[model samples]
Target: MYTPPAFRDDDKDSLIATIRAARLANLVTATADGPLATPLPLFLDETEGEHGVIHGHLAKANPQWRVPAIGDGLAIFMGPDAYVTPAWYATKQETGKVVPTWNYAAVHAYGPVEFFEDADRLLEVVTRLTNLHEGARAAPWAVSDAPPDFIQSQLRGIVGLRMPVVRLEGKRKMSQNRNAADRAGVASGLAASERPSDREVAALIS
Candidate 1:
């Protein structure tokens, strides 16, 4: 992630928040064959190591887990994003110097990839992940809601992943490069747009 100084977001807590908010993430790993990627719903565990750890599960048929990773796997988390038109910038009317760009927030986490098949650990990971996503529901569900034998059988078809985060990079390109007037113009334009994603970027700018 090549983040300019004005757009960089290195705050540890803020980086973790972005990851948590991005319920789904892309896991990327390189190998002798080629680059492999999987879209996964990963949870961050801040208590684990210096940076933190990530947990998730992949289907047994997914070849990503079987290949030897050449280096630390990267998890990409994306937040609200939108396309910003030059019409949204104050400079567009002044000198027409503004060009279109994208505004968004993202986090990149790097760490050694670890995969395991231990049933107990898998159960724990699944339970915690389930609770995290379901806690807000009126009727929350748990792993125990299913029969033990059925749950055990289901676990056999997937592999558990653990990545102890070694480094993190974050970026929030929310029109911070623009002047106050330009930023305000961008926010107002976005706020008036019908796209929900545009509305989200509007809130960030404001």
Candidate 2:
């Protein structure tokens, strides 16, 4: 999150886009015992608040939901990332001063943490999350597709999570700090890489 001025991303749309594209996130909270974290598939409700609201669930047995968080929780969303070699920098040849760095996009959302167990609300959250992820498939699955009793039993084993976002921070490091020639070199080098993520970084730079 230590973003330099050149790499800071203040655009709201860009921040939300990165968050939406991130299918998984790390939810972190501070507790009396210690810090607790969980990786989950979270969804954003853009209509809920001035910023937005985040919704997700954790296993009923996960201790993270049991502990009381002192204040706000942090949800971390990561986008495409790639390693950048100094060889891709024109400055490396000019002054041999360039070092390796990384190019990536990430967003951090902070909000008050709320845990709930209402069966009806849990069912609604599960249904919406399922539909959001499954909608892109040819044969999308639905919660109602399974036996009612079985689905109900499964829901009993989880707890719902809600966080109304109070702050959003985004960082996009895509060679923006480099000069035009160095940036062009980086783009060319990344575009030629076999790694899909590198090609994605190249596109962002372009």
Candidate 3:
């Protein structure tokens, strides 16, 4: 994340909020073989460490968990993102110096990666993860809802991941570098876009 001072999000709460809202994240690690990455749906336990702990799982067949990571693993979480055209900038009309850019929010968490396959801990992790996502629905489901033997068998196919965050970095590029007029124009243009994600970026800018 090459974040300029104007676009840096240093606030802890803001960083955690962006991470929580992100539905999917990329987990990356460096190894002797090469760099390995996996897209995962991770959740944070804010109460765990000075920063926080991240929890998720990967398929047992995924080789990422087998390789030893050099150091801390990184989890990349992305929030609403939209492309900004120079046409949306007021400066483009006056000086024709404006260039296109992107507006988005993202968080990167770094921590030592721990992998486990213990049935009890795996079941607990699966249960919490299930509740976190399913809680939004009217008929929320739970891991325990399935037959015991079936759930146990399912858990065997995946490996649990636990990363206690050692550091966190966040970036929010929401036209903060632009002048007020240009920012307002961007907000207006994004708000009027057909993409729902664009509207979300607009709201963040406003």
Tens-digit per-residue lDDT, 71-184, candidate 3: 899999999999999998889889999888999999999999999999999998889989999999999998878999999999999999999999899999999989999999
**Cα lDDT of model 1 by residue, 75-160, tens digit:** 99999999999997888889999789999999999999999999999999999999999999999998999999999999999999
> TM-score for model 2?
0.97
Residue-level error in angstroms, candidate 1, position 83: 0.9
Q: Which candidate is the best by TM-score?
A: 3
> What local lDDT score does residue 56 receive in model 1, on the 0 to 100 scale?
98
In candidate 3, stretches whose alpha carbon ends up further than 4 angstroms from where it belongs are none
TM-score of 1: 0.97
Ranking by TM-score: 3, 2, 1
Could you tell me how far off, in angstroms, the CA of residue 186 lies in candidate 2 after the best superposition?
Answer: 1.2
Please state the error at residue 134 of candidate 2 in Å: 0.9
Clashing pairs in 3: none
Q: Number of backbone collisions per candidate, in order?
A: 0, 0, 0
lDDT of 3 at 61: 99
Comparing 1 with 2 on lDDT, the higher-scoring candidate is 2
lDDT (Cα, tens digit) per residue for candidate 2, span 1-206? 78899889899999999999999999999999989999999999999999999999999999999999988999999989999999989899899998899999999999999999999999999999999999999999999999999988999999999999999999999999899999999999999999998999999994
